[model samples]
Target: MPAKRRPRRPADDSLAANLRFFAILMIAAILLRSLVAAPFSIPSESMLPRLLVGDYLFVAKWPYGWSRHSFPFSLAPIDGRIGGAVPARGDVIVFKTPGDNRTDYIKRLIGLPGDQVQIRGGRLILNGEPVPKLRVADFLDPVSPNSPCRPVPGLRIRLARAADGGAVCRYPRYRETLPGGRSYDVLDIGTTPADDTPVFVVPEDHYFLMGDNRDRSADSRFPAEPGGGIGYVPAENLVGRAMVTFFSTDGSAGWLMPWTWPGATRWNRIGEGF
Candidate 1:
């Protein structure tokens, strides 16, 4: 006769199957966020015109290769970036704020390694040549809890709705042309302290970032200390290059309310490319 077989426990087999499914799902998530793309949300007007405060977009991790910063919470134990790639002049990027590894900052890559950068009279000067800033149509921002277009430095305005239940805010806008024929929109609030800055030569393996909102942005132009301004960002700190906008909201919706999605979502901005 054949040898007797022990009975299998159905509950134990089911528990093992559940654990395996969760493990595989977690691995897939980490791989996608690390090697393919990851989602990020805009929290400020630093990247205005193209990116808004309530916009949610994807950052492509493959463009700049693998680095510790590519991982969520930067949990990797590597020394530096592997298969690293430098972001282009006009490419928008997300990186760990210099000196404060915990913070993530997004901005346009202006000064590349060894490039001389400065702001003179509300215009960007690269390598002693002034980058052209031409006046453009006013940039209109709809009045909402999310689109106040508020500038930095403790300035606040009471937002109000229009008579038609819709309103908009306006600001002076301009087109800034960087070297290599790249151009983007910028907003300027006349003159500010950053309008004139001393020439800063970008060091090797480093980059200088700036915001499209000009004077309102606290980028490499300020000290990265208690003032909380971002300074020169390192290559190893790079997270990824911004690719496209996935979703956006008007800041009037809450998580528990599903009905608000139709009105609160900015459908036009969805699938917008960076």
Candidate 2:
């Protein structure tokens, strides 16, 4: 006698089970993105010579711990932040604007809690000492839809031709060495009102930030206003620390042109670590 076989699951029930499995998977993915790491895109030139427009990078969420700001739409239920850690100066961070608590801004952390920060004569002064600013080679940014050579008041937008015949925008770049020897390049486009500012004492649990593009950025130098400068950001507002550049484009790619995608990618900028 042949052994009896078990009845197969109903087709409707099987389909429902599969749907449930997929739903779980999607939720897991969303949780990972909200708590582990998430991708962020650079949409401005405030961090130029390092981060450029169209650059997509992953931000590690665990570095500064989790807060309501860490979750999408600031929906986390926990009060303040848990498992918090101190962020190092010179770490590029993403945070919610103090002005709105919704707008996200990325800038290099300059002044930590209880630190003094000021800008004078286009030089960064931290803790009453000047951060070394050494003149460096010009940053030859390729001109594209993403990076246009815009004219600044009282200054010319220097133009250059790349060896590959691409139009290039030349900006004076400098290397700044902060305390503890951490260093990075910055662009200084002549003088601006923000070049001089009174010393700012960072309050407890707050951090001061500034952009690499000294003259063009509306950072801590200005008063916090909606759709404008971000004042000192509270510790609870920190989102993540930038980890690596995953992808970049020159804004020349068109959705309708498949072949243009490859050529429009800024291959050299990808995989860059912060």
Candidate 3:
């Protein structure tokens, strides 16, 4: 004969309910961040004139498909990208730093595997051809925390008054057109050491990346350091493609100053495409 089932206890029922709810929430969050989309915050001015410090953007996970790097803790057990799609020449992307394969980095995709890339006189050289760069109006920069555009090493900056009477800093900005008509703005702080580099032949399963803020960035031009400089990023290290900026702040407001928060928000940069 079948034994009578044990009666469900109230305490046991409550504990099980709570555990189930927590599990559901964890599962949902995991799925959303992994399969759907993920939020990334810009911590530096590396991609300046395109992505600024304090910018919050969304990274679309589906563009390059899934690799082991796609999963948090990188536990996918996969070798290369699955359902992978080769990114275009000018797409802005966030990927794992080459040395660690753990640190997150955002930069423009400048070279593909086997592509010859270099910088000469601050101009990007792709496949032995110089990418066209057109000078644009000076980019007006306001005083923001950790803004790389200002306190420039060797240039005189003309100051301007903003509507709020805050001192405005100015930096030279230019438009760079890559091959196939893709173009974006970049900030140049005269010629720096990074402006000229030995020709880097992108290796198989690797990519060459550089920041729009050419003078300030230490990208593929620098050899990979354990926790610092990024070298040749592996194609499998790609996390996602930057799609849009959902929020931005200039660090003008303090946590205690709730009323000033809205004013500190960069409303104009919201919904900006990358």
Per-residue lDDT of model 1, residues 1-274, tens digit only: 9998888899989999999999999999999989899999999888877788999999999888888888878898877778856689999999898867868889999999999999888789999999998999877778778986455453322244555776776667899888789989988866788989999999998899998988668899987753367778888988999999999998988879999878889999999997
- Model 3, range 1-274, lDDT digits (tens) per residue? 9999999999999999999999999989987887668999998878877877888999999999988888887888898999958998888999999878888999999999999998898889999999999999987777766453356557535567777897777778989998899999988877678888899999998988888888878789899977667888888899999999999999888989899889889899999986
Clashes of each: 0, 0, 0
**Best lDDT among the predictions, by candidate number:** 2
Candidate 2 lDDT, 94-198, residue by residue in tens:
899899999888999999999999999999999999999999889999999999998766753588898899899999999999999999999998877898999
- Whichever of 2 and 3 has more lDDT, that candidate is 2
Give candidate 3 misplaced runs (Cα > 4 Å).
1-6, 146-149, 156-159
lDDT of 1 at 60: 94
Per-prediction TM-score to the true structure, in the order listed = 0.91, 0.94, 0.92
Number of the top TM-score candidate: 2
In candidate 3, how many Å is residue 109 off? 0.4
Q: What is the C-alpha lDDT of each candidate?
A: 0.85, 0.91, 0.86
Model 3 per-residue lDDT at 193: 83
